[model samples]
Target: MSVTIDITGLPQERIAFGPSPLAELGAALHALSEPGHHARLHGWTTTTAAGLKPELADRLHEADFMWRSTRSDILLPAQPRETLAEELDDLDRMDDERYVAAALEINCAGFYDRSGPSPLVDAAMRQRALDLAAARGPRQAAFVRRMLADPPGTRAWIRRLLEDCDEAFFADTWRRVHVQLATDARHKTELMRRKGLSGAVAAVSSALTLEEDAHGSRLVVDKLSDGRTTAQGSGVTFLPTAFGWPHLIALYAPGWQPVIQYPVSSGELAGVLPVETVKLRLEAVSHPLRMRLCRNLARASYTTSELADAYGITAPEVSRHLAVLKKAGLLSTRRRGRYVMHQLDVAAVARIGSDFLEAVLR
Candidate 1:
């Protein structure tokens, strides 16, 4: 049901927190390419996209798989890597075996074990990698073939693309965001000190929860795929980023310490959300009935008719509340058959506090 990290015997200090410049850079590139999805960063993404060189833009498209969905651990370090320069150097100097394994694991799911040791790239392992890549399609197959033929060359190409991205826009973006990230990490560290591990882990994201049973304590993370990995005494690292909003990344790959990169609680850009925007959000949920609707929708999506029936109100009345929420961008709706189902935008609603602060200060 969830990805969990066993923390029964894990010590407090072993659980660490920090900012990862490489991860932030990767997320920023991903945001630039997919601007529609990350509406929150529209202003920054637009500016960054205009400045990107044609060649760098083409390469980002060419190796789109690197940052899409589950980002390749090759691009994202599995620990708290401090500086972009240092991380890039380490990635450039990575050995062939590890490079191939990490890159192949991106497209070839289940090619390696998370709990087991990192497999050596023997002849059989190479064959399996190729076969899995072939099943994924020509593009993936070609990438894997190139990796197999020359690991160093392939890694170099990937590194250069990242370096180009840094030169183009990410360096400036990093300078602006690193302070916010460091501040957030410190805030979470304080939460850990005051509330212990569970409180801090819960604060990272709404999707993560700390639980315990006969088997021992584990930090459960909501993810599309389900798997469990133990701390193994190495503990886990938590990294906060401004670009990776509405999504949380957890890496439990073999041969590296587990790391979870979460979005900052506050809006990415300070003083970006206007006062009018904050006013609209507050007015959307100000009504008692609308507030109730939001609470219910947060738990689960419901149709207008379903909500009306549950509340003993008319469908038209429910529709009015849904309309207000939708107008303020507080809800998302989809048509399921004849009924329109409405769900609250949890991330957008959660940003009210931060947005309010920015608006007030501005």
Candidate 2:
């Protein structure tokens, strides 16, 4: 429901603010996956739409499409880069081990499972695997199956997929709007300089549902579920975004810095949506995909990633679609271990359908 991040006694220098290429890469991928975001970023996406792998291109166009793997701490940098170029360079220099760690860390797609021998088999990594086991999807499973079968040669594919995504989707937008991001970072830095950490936070608090009192700052991101993470001296890094609007993402990696990313226009990120909500039934089944998904779930329940895989889309796409439908009262969802499952409200669907028919008949 909300995440309260503890930043007690965190030095001002520890809290750095800047734009990150890695963060934007995730946002750009998000833009491609979500229809609303696609609408906002149409100019950039259309240019590179042709270069993406055929299936990926089609998936991207699908209103329900989503990319799940990018939501990892390994993909984000612990330190702030002075410029987007520097951030990109930092991203490009990461070795395979780091990529593999991230891949294994959030293997909701089952890539590491069906493949050959894995370092993840180790006890420490094994626990991580169990934690993420519930979120695996067919597409990621298939990708891993293919990679393990091909091996050595296909290893490059992982990095290439990420690099291509960043180059195609985020590069142009970054170059065009990076100055604005710098301005944002400067504004926040100046706030901390003029006032204190609390002052800077208080200033930004006006833009978000964030609260700062005796217990540090609690950024109310309803999608985050009810959890709290201490700043731990890593200093909070605020990433201002353009396309990844409406969704507030709070990321904490036990040894890495805790990062809070919000849309540049975060007027009310929390005190609201939680990834699942209730709405006025009629508005729920309005969209074709939402209705289709509702019907699909009418027969059974499926996790967000599973639904995405079945529909040949991405997790975020399905997540966003489901969020609206849930809010509109068309569906209900639950979390089982790491997997979040959704079910169609059959009675409500029937009621709404009959209501529509009766109105038309009259």
Candidate 3:
């Protein structure tokens, strides 16, 4: 069975910023702050009577050009400061177009050559595979069976099958089968339950199969105890065009909102800036108790009890706040005998400070 998914109702608004360039830059930078946000912000279009507005079209074109140009070779160093400082310096000196181009070039290069999938693509594919596995279970089983039966088929035939199959069918079926086989073959679920209920939940939730095409056979197991079908041979291949850009744009861009938005202030937008830095600075200084603790540690690293005594907080409260700061990457700890001494993570603090400054300046 062939299934086609039509995605519609994409956002058509032209990309517009506040009156000031600074405000615009801030919004754009903030949008890129979160993972995958840049792609969504830069990858949409509006069908206006005037044709594409020059500025909006230029921004979109630039984004794609940067993405493709750097996709093959960008590497982010372990320390973000080294890269971020250089990028910020470039932004300070260059024109908007040059700034955006350079920043995106570095971003794309770092991301593409990194050790993982692009955040946007990874989330999209995972959801797609899950939906496909759930919705067309039987059809997926049939497809797998056909593939196994004809390992040496022409690329054209394989492409036709992949394109024709409903988007939901294969993923839904694959997920169901993948889970059941994992449970039955490894008794993983049973073992997880013995560890704890949370473990059992995680085990059951770990659905979906990750297989290289070079594998000899891919098995589809039926949870209803119906049976199993294994696809044999060289495996199936899919064509790029089968995954159309329109469908992808629809999938990734669900709504038309800018990846980042800046709330306009009453005056001219020229002075608008990110308030995150101010917030962070206030957070760093606001609590007298936390400040005391920080001051004590600054003199020299100290155990929780030592700082707690100096600050007059209970041991538990001190531990709790320390845990929070540590998770924020503001603090680092080391065990010295029975005591865990706490100290600041300078690099993390610097990065947080720098990011705030950049956002505000933008």
Models 1 onward score TM values of 0.68, 0.60, 0.21
What are the lDDT figures for the candidates, one per model? Answer: 0.71, 0.55, 0.30
lDDT (tens digit, per residue) of candidate 2 on 240-289: 66655544566654444677775665321112333343246656666667
Worst 10 residues of 1 by lDDT: 353-362
216: Cα error in model 1, Å = 1.9
lDDT of residue 299 for candidate 2 = 38
Q: Would you list the rank order by TM-score, best first?
A: 1, 2, 3
Model number with the top lDDT: 1
Which ten-residue region of model 3 has the weakest summed lDDT?
A: 243-252
**Clash count in backbone of candidate 3:** 11
Report per-prediction Cα RMSD to one decimal.
10.7, 10.6, 27.0
Top candidate when judged by TM-score against the true structure: 1
1 or 3, which is superior by TM-score? Answer: 1
Tens digits of lDDT, candidate 1, 1-362: 35777778788888888898888887786677556336688788888778777877777766665665345776666565667889888777777777667766654455334432222447766776665455344665687788788777878888887888788778887888899999989989999999998889878877788897898888888754456777876888888889876557777676666778888863443334679998998998778677666645653456676577556799999998899989999899987555566877756775676432222211
